[model samples]
Target: LFVAGPILLVELYPARVEFAFYRMSLCTKLGGLCETDCLTFKEKTGSCRADLTPLCCRKGKKH
Candidate 1:
């Protein structure tokens, strides 16, 4: 017998969706289209202020 566990979630957009909202796990202090081109982490301070994180969100689309 096999048991299925909770699925993993990520900040990824569905390929089928033409216009989808990109999401981040943690809310961004910066507003508007949080890009993920650059991300930085500081384990010493237990803080991460990357241009983006590993979280995705969903919003209503016009399609």
Candidate 2:
């Protein structure tokens, strides 16, 4: 038999929008590209879809 542990919900979300904002902000100060998908990201909160980007994936846990 196989055993499974408790599953978290946050792990399902991706951080694309958040990353874009952070990255863009930093890049702007450094005279880099301030790229951001305002249209799509505006509809999303802190976390986006998990299947989208792996960088924003969280286990609903605070690190």
| Strongest candidate by TM-score | 2
Model 2 worst lDDT window (10 residues): 52-61
Off by over 4 Å in 1: 3-25, 30-33, 39-63
Give the Cα lDDT of each candidate: 0.29, 0.36
How many clashes show up in model 1?
2
Each prediction's total of clashing residue pairs, residues at least 3 apart in sequence or on different chains, is 2, 2
**What is the alpha-carbon lDDT of model 1 when measured against the actual structure?**
0.29
Candidate 2 residue lDDT tens string, 2-61: 222223334323455565566545544543332233343222223322233312321232
Q: lDDT value for candidate 2?
A: 0.36
